[model samples]
Target chain A: MTTAAGSRTLAHPGLGEITLEGVLHAFADPMRMRVVRDLAREEGAELSCSYFALPVSKSTSTHHFRVLRENGVIRQIYRGTAKLSVLRRDDLDALFPGLLDTVLAAAARQAERRTAAGS
Target chain B: MTTAAGSRTLAHPGLGEITLEGVLHAFADPMRMRVVRDLAREEGAELSCSYFALPVSKSTSTHHFRVLRENGVIRQIYRGTAKLSVLRRDDLDALFPGLLDTVLAAAARQAERRTAAGS
Candidate 1:
């Protein structure tokens, strides 16, 4: 497979392979969870991989984005020079109702607690 | 920290540190997810770690259980010699409503599909 298709495959796992473990595995890392959170909160926003406030390198960021897409968490399409991403809200809701929102809410709470503790 | 508390710490991350990524990380591993699924469906039945049909050694099984509990996915309370485990339904539902159930449902479907494809 070429790099583009390979990346696409990584971009979205088929419905069959989109297990909860796979989805959770894709988002378990802090960076990846942050990426998904941004995607979840962004309304009609197609974010480029660079738009994230990640602490990783460019390649690592690319890798995280690819994992998110491949695990069926996010959908990606090439728009000129940037590969834009959006959460697979419909698909996710169909497979696991309320999970996306719950996780996002939990993450927000955690973020707030972290900030509060640091301050 | 002693091994018991260290292990307890592994058994449950505090409420403050429980994020989507952490919970997902706890369940991402197939073994751990399986354990969680069984716990979720047990309906008040507290299972022992040795009762699982895993492909790992005793020590690894212990480790997986530790990861699950520490992440707040399940509650581990010792009943004499046996460590009885139960899914922390209230806490999980509070933190991420319907996530555990959704993930379990998805996992069941995945298992069925895998079985059919293999046959």
Candidate 2:
């Protein structure tokens, strides 16, 4: 990435490199799904790793973000020691059409359903 | 009850019991995904376990199908000696709405893209 200059760059799958199974596996976990949902809320604005208050340990959290990046669901870059992440919305949409949005929306609905049931 | 009377029956998650992560995890595997795609092609008709010519062994195939059923992605029932399977499209659609169709369509597109690339 142009923004990845001068920092230890991370590897990500390009648009053509992403697969449906890989993306689904990355999203299958609750932690990774939370990161995706949070990034999607920003409307394309990149968010720092610290922005998401995950429930897991720091190392586990790192692993989650790495999975997301490696699966081509999100793009990660080191912006001066702050690893920022943003959903690869354009690429994912172009590759899978409505898959990402459908999953995200489904996730939101499930969250709401759980909350309602709990109440 | 009637169809399952004289044969072994399988338990499946009810509409309210299916979770987003559970469904995603079930769809994340290649073997289970193949079963899903095959079932989707049947247009809701229940196919027996042997209907899918999976490369995996019988036990492994059983495990995969069990994963799908437990996650609420598919329904399995035994008629005599054959365990028939079908996508829980109605239940899934009622709960997750367009999620199933979107994933299936994206998978079809991905398969076509891969075939074209290979050609």
Candidate 3:
């Protein structure tokens, strides 16, 4: 059957393992925080890991993405040679409603404030 | 002139150092999660660290409390012989909006589900 052939079924975290610590740690780094904010802004857009303008090495970038996936922050599905990253909004909402949005909005506002202060 | 004599003005982390990673790592442990949940429930109540029914030893317990305070999750003040712990709701709310309450409620719900399942 072609039912399972279309996509690589990624094992996103269930509600159990999505600890507050993991979520916070995942978004704590400035680079990871930007990745999360961009994902949130893009919503359902399937983003490639390379899309993020991170300052870290390729290995460090991989580590950050792994941390996010393991913590239920994002879902990743393999699409041929590239991996598609999407935020696990439903699971996160089921676990902590408004949390993802709140943090994202706060990050956006902080970014705006920083730009204003810098200029 | 007696200036700031009564209370030891604990130097809490300002908005800068309270990174998402530090906050999450602080509350990631199951014991620390419970402490945060209880603090949220109590609201403004000043809790003694010993109030928690944690499985860890006294010294380990001290470590957990230290992590919480250091991460800006809770504020600690020395009250004579005892150290008083209070959730930094204002700072958290200012930084991350409803993030604190959302996580606390989620934790409560998970605990409830666990109890129901165990029963």
**Tens-digit lDDT track of model 1 for B1-119:** 43554343223666665666668888788888888878877777899877786899999998898888778888887755678888888887777766777677777877877899899
Evaluate residue A22 in candidate 1 and report its C-alpha lDDT on the 0 to 100 scale. 74
lDDT per residue for candidate 3 within A1-119, as digits (tens), equals 56665466667778786866677667667778889988988889999988886888999998898989999999998876778799998988887777788778767766876788689
- lDDT (10s digit) by residue, model 2, range A5-79: 655888888788999999999989888889999988888998998899998888988989988998999898887
Candidate 2 collision pairs? none
User: Model 2, A38: alpha-carbon shift in Å?
Assistant: 0.7
Interface RMSD of candidate 1, in Å, is 2.2
Runs of candidate 1 exceeding 4 Å displacement = A1-12, B1-12, B116-119
lDDT (Cα atoms) of all candidates against the true structure: 0.78, 0.89, 0.80
Better candidate number, 1 or 3, judged by lDDT: 3
Please provide, for model 2 over B1-119, each residue's C-alpha lDDT reduced to its tens digit, 9 standing for 90 to 100.
Answer: 67646556667888898999999999988888888999998897989999999999999999998899999998888777788888999989988889999889888899999999999
Best-performing candidate as measured by lDDT: 2
Error of 3 at B42 (Å): 1.6
Worst 10 residues of 3 chain B by lDDT: B1-10
Off by over 4 Å in 2: A1-5, B1-7
DockQ of each: 0.54, 0.83, 0.48
Name the Cα RMSD for model 3: 3.4
lDDT of 1 by residue, A1-119 (tens): 44654343233576766777778788788888888888877865899888996998898988888888888988888765678888888888877766777677767877876898899
